[model samples]
Target: MSVTGKYGGPLPKGPWAERLHEIFDRLLAAFGPQHWWPGETPFEVCVGAILTQNTNWANVSRAIKNLKEAGLLNPEALFSIPRHVLAEIIRPAGYYNVKSERILTFVAFLMQEFSGDLDAAFSLGLWDLRSRLLSLKGIGPETADSILLYAGGYPIFVVDAYTARILERHGLVGDDVSYDSIQSLFMDNLPSDPALFNEFHALLVALGKGHCRKGRPRCETCPLAGIHLNP
Candidate 1:
């Protein structure tokens, strides 16, 4: 599963770093800065990260709007609300019943650990915070990393399907790479800055949505079309 090359020689870290930065530059030039994790508060961003799983941002927005309109976006309110009621409110997000449980599970963790204070929760060390987040019922690596980088302002890189597709297409990673391996490619190469990680991930999403489609990628006009492949 290594991305070094077919011959198993160690990949030169310097070139990989430079190429990663080049990809980032190209994406930035094409899409400009993308202020990501679109939410009003840190808590809201965490909620959006949870709700956005297996769904579109538009649906997550509607779900968040419903919560806000119903005065239930607060951790206390969400923690105290009935799961059925919550599910009905967030029905537009798809998998309402499951997502409701997931949100409430996170709310419970927030209340129990940090007394519902997001800043307090984020104040913990990165590994400690991420481990605790992963211990939650439905929060996986991507969701936990999203919460960490976007909501907690941590410097962890968040990898998604778009990121894997882009790297694989550019011969930077194996198609069967694990999540941790894909994530390590960025974390090992890029500077550990929250802003850079945020912008890079968002730009990848933009490219994924706009050009690097699943079935038929618009590679002819993609911003990274002419970029040198790692392999």
Candidate 2:
């Protein structure tokens, strides 16, 4: 897509910025804070980000609850547990064996790089920490950004299928664009604020689930119904 610019930085007042603002405002008006990433701690958020790969939140929640009940929710404890046992505990999240290894990988990275302190891992400036996360075995762009934004409160926007569907439907971004390209639409136009990114992403997920669905979109009732549609 022809979205990326030469400077690749936040733009001045323009259509792009205004459109993003309009979307955020309308979505917020329709739905309040989503209280997303329902985790008790940053470590739990990180675990959720990893466990949520290809699964719904309901299943991920069950898996996490199992971990907590077993007293293996912390990184240090999870790291010491047997791989197969960890896999069994998180079986509810699906892809148990693989997710088990991935969670262990992330915990080990934390233990080694930051001595099991999520704050230290989060304190590594956005790009640095994101790069480290993307290097892990199963962590991809969406997963890494979820860890960064939802867990560490980083200022980077997390792009997912829902965000992509909304932007494409509104003609803000073309269909099947690269993740970074779609992400630039917000990160390059909106002010760099973690709170804004967090709530905006959550709002998009809400819209995607409630109205702008994958199979059949209810555009007429969508919060962003007529904002950016080229009529």
Candidate 3:
């Protein structure tokens, strides 16, 4: 099952799409389906995407809970709340001041451009919506893609640190590759289905958390242990 041998042969010449599908299949077989994007609504998913920047999901969950308790989860309520108040409420998420501003800015954008309707906002074509989202102050590619895939149901692959680590280690991509390039490796290869993209990204995250961790990985028990790197 190794991708390379002691002789250090050349990398597999198979289509990257097929290889990626194989990896996906292996991951799916190992982890089952991951019902990701732990949110009750599209708006909540978008909020979580923002708050999750540079933080863990537990903190994001606590912050979202705070908003829910205050009945401020909707666009109008979030927009009307004072920035300082919002920051205080989400203080547990870390960098609360900046995150509060980013959230408020996103809410304002939604209200002004889409009349506070998430469906309308997401209805734009994929590239168009992604461009609009990336134009916002704090939202970057990962965040934008997360919103597109998980919240808006767009067929776009979301690449993150975990994805980069796995691909680089497996010799599928260089460490210096751009996010778009890495993402295209999945998007251009896999079927353009939001559900597939969602599950694939979740499975990658799960692998990263459990096996392909930072520094020395616990490769022996990794489901991907059979994979060998290119010479």
Candidate 4:
């Protein structure tokens, strides 16, 4: 899987999408769709995506619990809370100061753009919503896709470290691949369905965690090993 430079080379075609689908199907057969972004509300999903940045889900869960306990889980309440208080409450998520400010920034945008209505705020057409989200201060491609696919029911594929690592291991995408390119690869090949996107991303995370790791990739026992015979 060693390549010359990063990204911008030929893409993995042929049975590429089929192989990816096969891996996803096997994982789903084993682990189910995961139905991720577990939250009682869309606002909670969006908040979780923001807080989950650069941290694991366990810490994000703790931070969400903190907000729920403080009754600051809603948009209005979160917006009204003092910055320091919010930061203190989300301290378990790490980088609390910055994440708190980022949350406030999003809440403020929601208030101004959609009158504190998350549904309305997220009601824009898919591309428009993604563009608007990307324009936000702390929202990058992954966060934007998370909010779009999980929270707003868009079909865009969300690329994470796990997806990148899996693709790199299979020589699908290079290390320096641009976010848009990797994202487009999946979106272009797969049918545009939120459920599929959701399950696909989760399966990639599962595979990355279980096999395609950072240093020592478990290629021998990897689920995708047999699928990528030519690679």
Candidate 5:
């Protein structure tokens, strides 16, 4: 809605695009396309977003298979299933009890507010949708952005540990920058392009996993070595 700093100036195009491209090129050269946010449908994307909290894709995949085997991956089915049953099913994903409640809460919100129509839910303006999602329990900044970026195809930059580390090290932002501030740095500077947000976030995640780790960063092999912020 507010297209001020989020979309005003010249977004990352031309030489800026080249910088992004170089980042992507080196990442792709090492890891390939990634074909991220792995899911068959948008519903699955939303579900995966919830299931992936504090877990890896492999565990999330197992949990999803559990839901699929139980025939309750859809909104109605997920909502109707007994909470304990759902928790049991998703046990493999870790934090089963809490995540079960989170999934149900989000699905209930969808059912009540949007009649379970995902497109309708997404039709709300970016800020409105994000605000509404933040009101839900367990839907923190990262989770809300993940749903917006992957599920709704909104051009909202998703920030996580990797993004914070990369940006801070690159001197692009302060160490104490809030989640919204860090995300704003990207959304303000980059074009409001869903594809770019999606790919860039995924690339940052890859970089974090491979190089910018917190405890033991591998700066020697890092592509963004010279770009480190050292703040």
Candidate 6:
């Protein structure tokens, strides 16, 4: 409801901002707080973001727990292991081999660039850090933004299938909407607070899983059920 964010910039007063704010309010009222990212440390959060590429959080949690039990959750310890062994360690997350390579590449990048100091790497400007992360072989936009926002505490919006699905179902976005478009819709229109972005994204995920499910959305019972976006 505030016209400006604590960190970002002045928000334009328009239909998009109002509608997005209303949606965020409704979701927060329905779901309260989601306490998302589900990791104790920034490194763990980054690892979860990568491992969660094609799997659920449950699977990711198992894989992370395995790493923690093995005392290899940090970048250096994880980077030290053989790829096959790393793959075996994260077997529960599905795509173990590919994810292992990705994790190694990320860790390698971290080690080589910052001596495994994530704080140092995150100290760069938003776009600079984003560009560096996107240049990695396995890190895509969503994954990169997840690390930036959730791990680095940057004010960036993260888009996922749940986000796109809910927006499209509510007539806020068209079918086949792009990741960047959805991301820009929120970033451009909303107050650029990491806490708001973080909670809003998490709440959308909750709605997607609980009501606006793919191929079987229970729209009648959804929190955004009666409110239509005036596009």
- Candidate 6 per-residue C-alpha lDDT over 1-231 given as tens digits, one digit per residue, 9 for 90 to 100: 322432355665789998988888888888888898899999999999999998899999999999999999888897789999999999999999999999999999999999999999999999999999999999999999999999999999999999998888777889988999999999989877898889889999999999988889898888898897858
After superposition, candidate 4 runs with Cα above 4 Å error: 1-14, 229-231
Measured over all alpha carbons after superposition, the RMSD of each candidate to the real structure, in angstroms, is 6.0, 5.0, 6.1, 6.5, 4.8, 1.9
Q: Tens-digit lDDT track for model 2 on 114-175? A: 88999988889999999999999999999999999989988899999998888787776778
Candidates' C-alpha lDDT: 0.89, 0.86, 0.87, 0.81, 0.81, 0.90
Worst 10 residues of 4 by lDDT: 1-10
lDDT of 5 by residue, 1-231 (tens): 122223334556544444544555566566655576888878888888888999998999999998888888789898788889899999999999999999999999999999889999999999999999999999998999999989899888899988888767766667898998878766765677887678778888999998999898998988776642332
lDDT of 4 at 46: 91
Residues 43-71 of candidate 3 have per-residue lDDT tens digits of 99999999999998999999999999999
Q: Work out candidate 4's RMSD over C-alphas.
A: 6.5
Instruction: Please provide, for model 4 over 1-231, each residue's C-alpha lDDT reduced to its tens digit, 9 standing for 90 to 100.
Output: 111111123334446556555666666765665778788898999999999999988999999999999898888898888889999999999999999998998898888889889889667899998888889899898988998888988878999998887777667778899888988878776666677778779878888888888888887877676666223
Ranking by TM-score: 6, 1, 2, 3, 4, 5
Point out where model 5 deviates above 4 Å: 1-30, 228-231
Against the hidden true structure, what lDDT does model 2 obtain? 0.86
Error of 4 at 45 (Å): 0.6
**Model 2 reaches what TM-score against the true structure?**
0.92
Please report the TM-score between candidate 4 and the true structure.
0.90
CA shift of 83, model 3, Å: 0.9
Cα TM-score per model: 0.93, 0.92, 0.92, 0.90, 0.87, 0.95
Pairs clashing in candidate 1?
Answer: none
